[model samples]
Every structure is written in C-alpha cells, then in structure tokens.
Target: MKTALCIGGTRFVGRHTVEELLAHDYDVTTFTRGIHDDPFADRAGVSHIPGDRTDRDALESAAAEVAPSVVIDFCAYHPREVKTATEVFVDARYVYVSSGSAYARPDVPMRENGTPIHDCTPEQATDDSAESYGPRKAEGDRAVAVAAVEGVEAMAVRPMLVYGPHDYTERFAYWVGRVAEYDRVLVPGDGGSLLHRSYVEDVARALRIVAEEGEPGEAYNVADRNAFSLSESLELVADALDTEVDVVGASERELAAVGLEPADFPLYTPRPMLVSTEKLASLGWESTPKADAVAATATAHVENGRDGAENGPARKDEEKVLEAMEETSA
Candidate 1:
C-alpha cells in the first residue's frame, strides 16, 4: 500500500484531506496531539501518531518511524516548522498546505507569480517571524521548493476560503446560519470585494493531485477562477436556504467597532485579492461549481438547526471551541 503521512489532519481541510487520502487507498497515518476526540482515530487503514509539530524531537522520532512515501503538512504556520519537518523526512514528497493569504498584495485575478512581497503585518505574523503570514508561508513554499529531500518532490497549494461539512470556523456557516434566520444579512465592507472560495472536497482533491501529478518547485493557486464577490456569496446562501435576506453593507471600521474581526469572515477581503486557477485547471484540477458548493453548505447548516437559530448538529469538540470564542469576546 502507498504510505502517506498527514501532519495536522484532524480538522477542516486537513480532515477532508485525510478522507480523500484514505479513499484513494493510501495507507494513511495522521499525526496530532489527539487533544480532543477524533472521529477517525480508530479507523482501519489509518494509524494515529500523537506528536506536537512545535516539538522537533517528538516530530523527528515520529517521522523516522513512519518513513512515508508522501508528507502533507496541513497546519504549518511558521516557515521554520516546515523546515524542521522537511529536514527530518528527507525521502518523502512534501505537499505544503498554504493559504492564498500568503499573497500579500496580489494583483487582480491573482496568479502564483503575482504575490510580490512577504507582506503580513506584525500583528498577524509577530516578531521572531521573518515573513508575515502570506510572505512567511511563501518563504516556506520556497524552502520546500529546493528541499534537500533526496528524490522528494515538493509542491505548494494555496487554497482560499475552504468550506464544506464539519467546518467549525463557522465563518461561511455563520452567513448561512444567520440568513436562515434573519431577513437582513449584514455584509462587512463593500459587497464588491472580490474573493475566492474552494469547497473543502475540491481542496482535498487538489492536494491529492499535487501528491500524484504536481510539478516540483511549482506554486499553484488552488482557487475557483470564477470567484464571487462577498455579496454574491451571500446571495447564493440565501437562495440555497430558500430564504430572502437583505444585504446590508458595513465598513471594515464598522465591523471592528462591533468587536468582530473582518478576517474572521469566510469570504475574506482586506483588499481585492481574487485568484486565477488556470494553472491548476491545466493540471486537470477544478473546483466544484459555486452554486453546488453553496447548496451543500446550506444543507449542512440546515441540518445543524441553523434555520431555527437554536438547533443544528453538534460535534461536541467544535461546539466547545465556538463557545470559548464567544465567551472570550463576551
């Protein structure tokens, strides 16, 4: 069986990535702290390796044992962490799960080459952090590009606003949930803020492609080329829920006033950062139609009791995190 090591494979895109890997018949071993309950920690064809990414010694010992054919790092925030992981697993192909946010100031219809600088703010990336999130992540991408991993091909995939089942971020789901209840949906900033969306499954599929067919040292934008504005996304959700919701625009400043961070939105936009996926498409990767993705998201929201505002499927662990966030803010 083909062996794959998925670091940080228990949530969001990572969870979907693991499921996709397993479906493809890869012998999957997931490395996480198992801090909370994992739905698949006990499944057949998968092994759970408990370790901390920040702890190099623990990671190295684990990597030595797995000796996987491919390594996908899904939760790497610091470039150094990636360097450590790559250095230890010198024989495995590395697929770095990066963010479109790494493109600090991308031009319209963002291409991988257009991200000019590592321009994340100090607040976002912090000191001891050389690059901001975008730039820092880009730097990590570059490190993996020339990785010393013998016979190990490395590639980076930058996905934007990944959403689907099991999303606790509730960023996209918030809009879906809110609109399912309130007739007026408030949008933070001009509705025209162009952005990209990728269904979680599409992102998982792209990662598999990178493992199977991606070119070494290549950075591909894994985005839905025909991205929608924040307004359009809201409209899609409204339609999916069979509900009519008014779109009320609020400035970023206004959002901050309410103590809500704009970055928290699933349809993220500090500025216009639309992406072009012609490169990935040429590689035969395509995102799900936005309408279908939206509908699925809406369906999940409805099943979770979002339409009624007091009900929805509750995954206990995710609910704890959401509750903590709300409590802290309160």
Candidate 2:
C-alpha cells in the first residue's frame, strides 16, 4: 500500500484529508502537536506521530520514520515552515495548502496564472496578524516554487473559504443557525455579494489529487464549481433545513443604525471574491454540488449544536436593525 504522511491532520481539512487518503487505500500517518482530539486514533489504517511541525528535528524524525510517498501539509502558515518541510520531504510529492487570499487583487475569477500573488514583506512573513495572512500564504507558495526548481515535487493548492462538517471556523454555520431558528434573516449589502467557497471534502480531495497528479511548481485553485451570492447562500441553508425564510437585505445606513457595519458580518464582502477552479478540474477533479454540500453542512451544524454565535452580529443586534427597517417600510 502507498504510504502517506499528513502534517497536521487532526482537525478541519486535516481531519478530512486523512479519511480521503484512507478511502483511496493508502496507509496514513498524521503528524501533529496532539493538542486536539485525534479522530483517527483507533482507525484501522491510520496512525499518529506527535510532534511540533515548527521544529525541524521533529519533522525530520517523522520524515525518517514514515518515508512517505506523499506529504500533504496543512499546518504550514509561514514561508519558513514550507521551506523546511520541502527540504525535509524533498523526495516525496509535497502539496502545500495555500489560500485564495494569497491573490493580491480580487479578480472576478481569480485564475491561478493570471492573478498576481500578494507580495510578502519581511515583516509580514513573521507577523501573525489577520492582515498578513494572505501575504504569508503567498510567500509560502513562492517557497514551494523554489523547492520545485530543485527537482522536488512540490505544488500548492489554494482553496477559497472552505465550509462543511467539522468546520471549526463556524462562519457558514452562523447562517445555517440563523436560517434554522429565525423567520427572517438579515443579509448585508444588496444580497448579491459573491464569495467563492469550497466544500471541505472537495478541498481534502484536491489536496490528494494535487499531490498525486499536479504539475511540479504550479499552484491550483479549489472552490465550488458554482459561486453563490449571500442571499442565495442563505436560501440554500433554508432549503437544506426544509423551511422558508424572509431574507431581509440591509443597506449600509440601516445596518449602521444598529451600530453594525457590513464588515461585521461573517462572509460579507463588498466586492465579489471568486477563483477559477478549472486548473484543478483539469486534473480530473470535480466539486460537490452546492446544494448537497450545504445540506451536509446544515445537518452537521444541527448535530453539533453550533449556533456560530461568535461568527457574526448577535441576534439581538440583528433584531434592532430589523425593527428599524420595519418602521421605515411601514
């Protein structure tokens, strides 16, 4: 059986990637800090190596032990981390998880080759602020290129906002919960805001495919085959919940009346953010249908009792905005 080593596979995408590898008949071993619960602790074909990825000695030890044919890295946030992993796993096919944020500009359909990557300053590379996230990911992509040039089979997979089961981010769950509990939902902007997102399983599969079939030194974008508007997404959640909801579109002034900005809402962007998935699709990959993905997410949200209260404006604040709108309409 093909041996695969996953760096950081105990949570979120990492968790799903391990399952994907197992489904494909690979002997999987995950390397993590052991802080989070291990979902694969008793799985038949899965194992774990407790270590800090930032420590080169720990990574080297894992590399020496597994000698993995493929290494999917989910925890490499900085460029330095990518550089070290590429050097240590130089012989294996290494796939680095990058982000759509790495693209400098918000193009309508951010193509892998057409878009310019965000430049990382020396300060940005070391900083851990939210503002520096994209630049840091971009620099990590560059590091992969450097390794590929040295004959390392290194590639990058840039996934846009990922949502699905086991999503700790809970950004999407906020909408799922609102749709489930409320009769009317408050949507920011004109409700046509487009934010491309990928299903977690699709992203996990992309990591495996890119590691196995992608061209060295190239970056591939992964997102839902179809991008949805904010209003449409809420509608999808409602459909998944088997109910109907009044999606109330809120203007900037209306939201500000309740002391909330459009930015305050999770997944609300003034400009449309999209990425082209043709590059990844060309490798014989396909994305889950948006409806099916949403259904799965909604089901998981209910099962986990994730209200996503911290992800967006509180329900009480939303009610204030709704009351103001009602008075204006009346």
TM-score of each: 0.81, 0.99
- Error (Å) of candidate 1 at residue 20 is 0.8
Instruction: List model 1 lDDT by residue over 128-171, tens digit each.
Output: 54345676787777667777344557788888767787787676
RMSD of 2: 0.8
lDDT of each residue in 1-330, candidate 2, tens digit only: 999999999899999999999999999999999999999999999989999999999999999999999999999999999999999999899999999999999888899999999999999999999999999999999999999999999999999999999999899999999999999999898889888999999999999999899999999999999888989988988898899999999999998887999998888888989999999999999999989999999989988998787999999999999998889889
Against the true structure, candidate 1 has what lDDT?
Answer: 0.75
In model 2, the worst 10-residue window by lDDT is 186-195
List where candidate 2 sits over 4 angstroms from the true fold: none
